[model samples]
Target chain A: MTANTPPKALAFDVFGTVVDWRTSIAALVGQVLSAVGRPDIDAFAFTDDWRMRYLIGMRDFGQTGRGFVKLDILHREMLDALLVDMQLDLAEADRHTLVMGWHRLEPWPDSVEGLNRLKRRFPLVTCSNGHIALLVNMARHAGLPWDAILGAEVAQAYKPAPAAYQRTAQALDIAPGELCLVAAHHGDLFAARAAGLQTAFIHRPLEYGGAPAPDLQFQQPWDYEAGSLTELAERMGC
Target chain B: MTANTPPKALAFDVFGTVVDWRTSIAALVGQVLSAVGRPDIDAFAFTDDWRMRYLIGMRDFGQTGRGFVKLDILHREMLDALLVDMQLDLAEADRHTLVMGWHRLEPWPDSVEGLNRLKRRFPLVTCSNGHIALLVNMARHAGLPWDAILGAEVAQAYKPAPAAYQRTAQALDIAPGELCLVAAHHGDLFAARAAGLQTAFIHRPLEYGGAPAPDLQFQQPWDYEAGSLTELAERMGC
Candidate 1:
């Protein structure tokens, strides 16, 4: 967090940080819906609802002392509830396909190039709440060049939980200050900073895809701030 | 595993399978010894002794309910005992340098190219007894392009424990048969077979530095056997 001392490793927050979950999920869901005879349900609205429940479910689960469940399982539970509310009866395989959509989200356009650039300088790891398998699948699907995957699943805690930030540093065998969390969400940045991790804010204004929530606004000063990952790479001297 | 069925993912045993650890550790230790005025110590013998205790310590720790300790801590413990046995007192930094040698071990000559070739076809993950930080550092040092790092550390159980192999399969969301254990040691491959996972063997003859202990020899019927990782890649049709 100090000016002269640079972070030895950079931890990334995926989903809205590296990948475009909103548009990718909306498109993938519509295709699945078309195949499954449920094209009437709005894909974008469904994506919004699913995305909205993410942090709340994870936090509440941890708060209620439910020890670390993978986000994939949580997503499936949420999807099943939504399906029940809509009076939808889906095949098991179709339900699985819908849930597996999280594993195949597309990265932001600048993600691949920017990550490659930063990887050349510092070790790049995933600090997202997305579990290791989902992160790995998304990286392969999106061509994101992550050096290592560590975060919620590895730490057994979701972001904003101090354990998510601290345990990641422990996993990497680095001091919290030596690991920088690069995230589009202000809350994640705030949590990282509070956990003694260096913080970098990435502006992803369209993360909600014109839905007007403004998920990536720069709310406060961070160690570094940039409009895109490429800009972050440039600012970090990578 | 059935011959007709191909594994969905490849999990690698890193130390001897992917890296020339004996040579690397011997060289690194020799350098440290020479720098610390203990040039008379036998580096190869030291490396061999240190490596010889690896599996025993891991197995005993688990059986004795020590839980899953990271291999780095184990490595440090082994190095300290070896130091005491030799009556060699080293500076804290020099002692750390010797243990960190694991993180900088060189891969076999054929490893990088073969891994790059195989990585194109399968998601290559580490199934080594080494922990995540050790694996990540080694991968970076050796230029191994691993999709994810898992194994004893991630599973919190050493190899030969069914939990190690089963947990890795579960983490990838694949059936046990869909995961292949690619290792040089017969014991490791045998355990994988027992755990309902596929197995492949790659020869690494000089793993112990030619002190009359043979390694990397083709021993038995495996799902696949090859002279090198490149050959393994070819056998897998990668």
Candidate 2:
């Protein structure tokens, strides 16, 4: 690409796209539930429940106009509810540690290498539902190099909401069309595209907590599609 | 520090600490004035003048109920005013490139390596007055590997305001005492310390446009004081 054709920036969806949130959360839930002698707790279901709460929290924040609530706070709130629903109670210390699972998500195999390659040419950022601290710690833990972290918390709105993508584009000083959202989830890509951001759909295939059904189907037209970040990086000529 | 000793995330004050704004702005001014056929214009004074307008912009944003404005937009406004005051006429394209100097700041000589070392152990983030886009572009251009970008822009409040530091600490899900503000400027460190954040003074004696000045001094007790981020990294056992 010519110099003027170079992308000004690349923003990522962190949870499943950059970091393997499902596997990470599943592993943590398995270890914890096993330790508590509740080995049959359906770790995947519990993980899904926790994430569902995060989504509900964002929707509530939007409806109530309570301003932005960081992911950590929302995670803690959701974790408490999840524990109650699961009929598990733990000490405050244990609860705090469990709530921190969001900070220790594992990166997908190609995330670091792909982001590093992309960063050689374009600024790379995270536009996740995760709060700033959680994303920062996750980067430190996973060794993912990000130029900056943007989130629904920054916009006081979450994905599927136009403001989330718009706020990120605004923060990057790029027109919505100039910056592309690289995500594994079709819903996220659709939302980003709807907000006028170009979209790159990378197939994660196993994002839905490893459910039997495949998760890698494109729902709409996106600017790019790749099998993985590695493919995306190669296609970007990085 | 023991593992139980909570990690103290290092939040940096970006503008003059990580970026050599004076040099960057001086160079931009020299280029703009030269292009306009006045090679001997006081670019240094012009830089300071433009910076004064930036400060006014911040104050106005803070005093009014207006949200935080991105540094680029604020800079453009101030740049226009500065050009009018200097009685210079310039093409919009040239003015655009000149304002983009903020995106091309040079990292201090020891910055990248120092930050790299710190990144090996501690989370390194930007706690800047610069807008998120400005900081992100500066980091990308200067090879500053920030784990995340935190700013008054996110909090809608400027530095020295308690909300700026507190919002950062909250975002990180770390207590104020568990986060440290590292900077060459005493005011930033003082504000951080006052807001209950640990402080670290990194001496950048030449931050103010290379003019001769009094020896840099530290007024408050910081958790650590070091000459550079490399030294700070070593101190933190990175």
Candidate 3:
């Protein structure tokens, strides 16, 4: 598909694509660490470690068909294990607050404005691994103006699993070909394309903080590509 | 609960509560009838009959735990059966246009404004039997800004079924008591209350055209009652 004829709907990958989760999580952790007199800890490294654990958990879930667990539960469990590994002591309330940092992440500079522009033309939804409540709270906090929330919890399966993409298209009553999966991650785009969805790649060069960026170039042919969501919206004439 | 202590979230029954389905369906059927040269048919009565069949279908589905079907498919099936009973002869494309009348229903005069006000105070969503796609399309068409769409499609069960209400609250990660099910129908409110949800009743006296309205009076003591959506929002200080 060309820019002139965009897909009927756009489903976004939320955590790193729409919201700058790494920066937000590091900031939140820094504040919490300072409050607990543990500011010596590297908050950015902690955030990256937490995210790596989440990916491992999702991979394990995908490997084993163990019944679906909501992302919040998984995050809390990961936080508990991480704190134990780091020999950190924190109150239950503080731990809960830190785990909920996912809900308060800040959006990318152009995410809200570009989403609003794209929404006027195509129905916009989140097809992330986040649970519905997490997605709803994030959208409310970031003013992301999504038409519907569809993701792992709604599909009872996480990303890279065919069920997640298939269920989202089914829920929208649209064929997979009519939907576009927009993400900053090549893996997500590749999986969505394999599921028969059109794919758009938005470059997020700083998604990993000081760490080396993933391949921002389109590894293979995709439906669309842009430097940012705002450009994507402009390309689609939104 | 008092007006000072509102529920964490408000879940609305969409069909007759938020949208004036009776008037909208009658208007659509009237247009279809004229197009088919069958203007003599009583559009209002036809709509009533169609709705009655929908109720019976829901009841049957609830009795037998047959796997979930999207509301659109059920509506189309019912339309086919109704057309046959009415001895209507219309092309398949025209029949489809008439069946899609559900998708184009107009909202009640106060729905958009009242929901906007209430949304400021609480996360508002729909808990009707309508599928996710149906609710999303209707909200976009009528300008009803829903934070999330949760209903039969997500729960895989129709309303009055315990799972539907339970799943919606669970999806929002709120206790049933922290969720208010607002509806114009007493039966819906009763079922929601039975499932441990707070209930709010908004009067929609003209929900049924010439047919007598369902008991407009609250069948039992509900958490809240109002003459209209605007009144409900005001009572809640939204």
Candidate 4:
């Protein structure tokens, strides 16, 4: 298929695009802090620190020969480090609760209904950094209707690496151009475009929660751009 | 934790367990034969030949040093060789139609509703030899509500190989015994059990059409046995 063959499938970037990870994660941290008798800790700052480690971990691990670690493992690893760095003490069960809380994330209000609309027209699969088990549990918990959960673990590489995008397209048996990457971050779409995938920008302004989301602004010439997933459904004629 | 924990997810075997490929492929072969003015071809025998080659292909491809190949490509490859062996001259379009027909398979009458019921109780996934694309298309075509599609392509090994079942359990973040494999074939269930998975035997009496399915007899010690997908749901308390 040529570059203009209307994408046969929509590969989604799940973390911040489809779900309110910042708010959900902050809530988890806040709960843990309160339970541990240290409620004064800034939950958003802790979440941001953990997310920063996660991003850096994915970048370094994907580029190295570390050979595919699941995002759940990385998340727990980051959680452990942050606990030490922040000088917090907790029982093993609470620590486990904090790390596994990712599986209980809530969807952005418009994500589910809009995705339901989009699914009527396109096969919806995740091309997220989250591994299959995490995505499956999140889908079950958040009522996200993913046709398939695929990405980093299956591709053996994380996003922003060309293999991550190219391999996802290959998995769906479609030309890169025939599989559109629907992602919130500009860096993700840039890498997808570089890998010859069509790009659709879905704005998730509150992804960072009270911090400037520099990537949330519309980048020029994306195949489609919408403020909410519901708007994306309207734009896609779903 | 232990061998007795209830399964966290249900991984299904698609081919003869969820859909009647013998009947479906025979119908496709009959159409192609009629379209080529060779209606005398025994479509059932032809389908059996194609299936035999397919089974051999998967067995060899999975165990060999040959890198991962998607089932779609393998299906097309087998279709090409079968046409040559049968001395049939089908146009490229007709050849494509026959191979791609696997994506459009008709589910057994009980599959959709029963799977829907099961999905409410467990995260449903496919552990078929079919690749993600094939399973995604088949689910869309047949209304199979799979939360994830994973198998040969993702695991890089086919069923009866230890890696297939072991890797699926790992991908789900569950112990091998925590993933119940629901399949019709004893070889598949036996391998799964060997890999420490719980097994649910599904009886597809008409899978072989007019031929006897020797493995259809009750093999003792399966975790559960049911006559149909609906019955499996009932037995699983879905």
Candidates' DockQ values? Answer: 0.70, 0.79, 0.80, 0.87
Ranking by lDDT: 3, 4, 1, 2
Q: Over the stretch B175-230, how does candidate 1's per-residue lDDT look in tens digits?
A: 88899999988878888889998999887778776454333242568888889999
Residue A167, model 3: Cα distance from true site in angstroms = 0.7
**Could you give the CAPRI-style class of model 4?**
high
Q: Which of candidates 1 and 2 is the stronger one according to lDDT?
A: 1
Candidate 3 lDDT tens digits, B1-238: 3443569999999999999998999899899998888899999998999998997888667677677888888888998999899888778887788777788789999999999999888888889898888888888899989999997888888888988999999999999989999998888888898999999988887888645655445387678999788999998888
Q: What docking grade applies to model 1?
A: medium
Q: Rounded to one decimal, what is candidate 2's iRMSD?
A: 1.0
* A1-238 per-residue lDDT for model 3 (tens digits): 4543558889999988999999999999999999999999999999999998987787668667677787888899999899999999889988888889899899999998999999888888889999998888988899889999997888888888888888899899999888899998887888898998889988888899747644435267678988789999998888
Residue-level lDDT of model 2, residues A1-238, one tens digit each, is 1133445788899888888888898888888888878898898888887876765666456676666666677788889988888778877876777788889999889888888888887888888887887887788788887888886878777876899998888888889888888988777887787898888888787777456323235376567878788889998989
Candidate 3 has a DockQ of 0.80
The positional error of residue A43 in candidate 2, measured at the CA in angstroms, is 2.8
DockQ computed for model 1 against the true two-chain complex using alpha carbons? 0.70
Query: Which residue pairs show collisions in model 4?
Result: none
Clashing pairs in 2: none
Interface RMSD of 1: 1.0
RMSD (Cα, Å) for all candidates, in order, is: 2.4, 3.8, 1.9, 2.7
Whose DockQ is greatest here? Answer: 4
lDDT of 2 by residue, B1-238 (tens): 1133444788998777777788888988898889889988899898888877775666455576766777777789889999899898889998899888888899888899999998877888788888888787778788888887886888778887889999888777779888888888776777787898888878777777666422235366566778887887888888
| Superior by DockQ: candidate 1 or candidate 2 | 2
- Global lDDT of each candidate: 0.85, 0.80, 0.87, 0.86
- Return the interface RMSD of the candidates, in order shown, one decimal each: 1.0, 1.0, 0.7, 0.7
